[model samples]
Target: MLLELHVWGPAFSLPSIDAQCLATMTYFSLVLPKDAWVLVASSDPSVSPTNELPALRSGATWVSRFRNIVDYLRQYSGGEWDLDRDLTGGERADNIAFSSFVESRGQSLVDLSLYVSSQNYWDKTSPAYGAILQWPNQWILPPKIHAQAKLRTEHLGLSSLDLEAIREQKDREHSAAVAAGKIPKTLIRNPRETVSTLLSKTSQQNQFRLEALTAEFFEPLESLLGHQPYFLSPDRPTTLDCLALAYLSLADIPDLPFSWLRDAMRSKAPGLTAYTDRMRRHHLGLEVKVIDALSATSTSSTSSPSLPWQAPERASFATLGKTLYDTLADSTPILKHIRLNNRLREAALAPHSGLSGKESKAVSAYALARKHDLYLSIGSVVVSLAALVGYMAHIGLVGFSLAEQEVPSGTDPDPDADIDAVVDAGQVGDFLSML
Candidate 1:
């Protein structure tokens, strides 16, 4: 089948690392057919998340609207996760490529667009999406994650589509243009959205949504393992893994120490501690601090630790779970990739087919784009590192600006002329099978 694989990247993979997105994208990329129209909905299309922008080549269509994708998906499969049912090999590969770019929906803490885009979605959903959700009262079981998808539909009100007049009004200005697979204008980080400003903007409903999700969806699951200190079980991982993954992954915000429950991790019965350590080594592909930062804090600093965020077992069981994950899931791949470091790694760069000559006129344009990518990811590493170890020069944490110009070593093709004839298969293959 000629596939119209539409991606409504409302909250793309670039925002965080997500498990389902990882799994689904992997399976799809490895198995889906070629020549599929992979429509990627990004608030900004010019900003490529996959790193392999490759000038859109011949297969992909980047876009930016949630409803547009809903309409597209309606053309293929319907609700309740029918995405990976029976896809071919090429179809699976494209899905993996798309998935590899999704941002983790779970804990992309500063996702301001989720708030700003509502200024558009709620203006459209008439007859009320809430009404549709309530039609089946028996299905009113508390939703898995934040469950904000229900209320947010009001944001996608039918006013835009003019459901009553959609068929007749040819010149209507509906938000469904987003569904057409074109990038819409969206602000990445609302300049006004400081940590304090964002906290203030959080509606009471958002608080309840988060509270309910934490108390109901996440806590009980954490409760299952008793008051242990870690989440991993034995030598293998469960299908239900990735729940607390972000809580640790994003804990790199030094000013804000990690606050996951410690007792559950420390418990020896089910034995979570060792498993967590091992998973950090395996899945995350990064080093994790297993020892409680709180204990380390008190012992290391004669100066009392400034922040109030200790592990849950240290005091009252204060819960902080994600409401965004359920809404994004398979929908936005780029944002999911951003949430996880799956997008981060050193690899041999591929020459874009866009290059016409040994030194095409487009070199300047391409260099600028490469510079932007370096700053966004690699530059962030320096910016996040405090001046407590300031060794060089420039902006906020801007010591190594020119250092990025260096070509990556061990990856230069000329260095190894002997093994150059075969088609190079990248991480795409290995990443797909894992899903």
Candidate 2:
């Protein structure tokens, strides 16, 4: 089972799928049973995308990231997640915030390659790698069916969002409009609150951008499983924890905050509310606030990206991106594959297929040095031993020849003479010859 997540490059950087996540998911997908699910909780550059966690979770199968992942290390036994019984208030909330660091903050936000990744891990498989993205026809989750998540947004009889204040004033305006019998222009406070239209973009360019982000993380995950995500899972093998975790994890992006998913516990997936409650108690929660627009651009290239994005340029994310092509020259191909999980990049790295000029040279240099060192060590040892043996034989023969001369030149020097006879020959030359 493959569960596809839509990925969006960060407002300031490109996202990456690095070796660790790749190796992890690679080991995971490759190792799991054939029927596992893979879900890429997808997102475009907007506050609400159809594949966002709040919507996707409605159909997502229950798999606790904390519990299931820990169980994967069953021998190590991390124990069940601290969900309901303990951890409340700020402490539990803080755990969620910190886990984001454990999940999203450390890796690159976007990937630059797709082809290269697809080709490299194409046929490879592993026992522990539950998902592998190198395969095509990768699975994706359709939009939620008849799903509408609602939150009162009113705190203790007080208005929460500024939109909430506007909604309250609308009632006053509606009353006035009724008295005068005139239709109000701003009758609905927020269309998002009342309308059921999807906030997804219809442009192909936007779609390409979203696919890139989704693929960055998803491909590596798929590679690990050795299959596409099922969008559903029977056991803890493939769970919605990955779905719940992604949005809740990356909610720090101010421009693209996902408070809806943060508050989408019983409010959204009532069955998983306890899980969200567990997530909440574990310091996993989200909040939204305005950030500096200058600090938060989607793509950050010098010009525009190869594709369109809500981010500033390709370079902004590059400031913190570890999976960029330039960074992987010194890294392993697995690292390269994981860093930017685009098919193009992965294809470029394939042996005899995509080998770049510099990478080929680097491989050649490394091989040459290894071979040279081995030969030099073996040759030097053989020559030194051969010279020592030759020198010892020469000294023994020269001494025997002198002793035979001292023995009146009548007897032949025996080739098998004893050690004592050779020593006596030296003595005859030194002392007995005078006698």
- The numbered model that scores best in lDDT is 2
Q: Which consecutive 10 residues in model 2 have the weakest lDDT in total?
A: 141-150
Off by over 4 Å in 1: 1-16, 21-198, 201-208, 227-235, 242-278, 287-435
Give lDDT tens digits, candidate 2, residues 1-435.
332222222221112122222212222333333234232312221112221221111134322223233233332224232122244465435445533433452232211111111111122111111131111102211111101111121221212122333446766776677668675555633323431112121222234543444444443333333322221232332223343333323322212221222232223333333332343222212221112111233332232222111222222343334223433442565434433333333333433222467975665565556556656777887886676555545556556556766875567756666675677557545542333
Q: Which stretches of candidate 2 lie over 4 Å from their true place?
A: 1-153, 156-168, 172-252, 256-435
Worst 10 residues of 1 by lDDT: 7-16
Best-matching candidate per TM-score: 1
Each candidate: RMSD = 27.8, 29.9
Q: TM-score, each model? A: 0.23, 0.20
lDDT of 1 by residue, 1-435 (tens): 343322212111111122232222222233334344332221111233342211122235322122223223334445322333345576546444432222232233212122122332233221112322222211221232223433443342322211222222422333344455453556222122333333334433254443443333234334444544332233323222333333322222112111222322233212334434443444433321212122223332322122111221221122111223423542465454433332232111222322345444345445555556755875566654533234223221232334334547765534332232121222323333443
Please state the error at residue 118 of candidate 1 in Å: 11
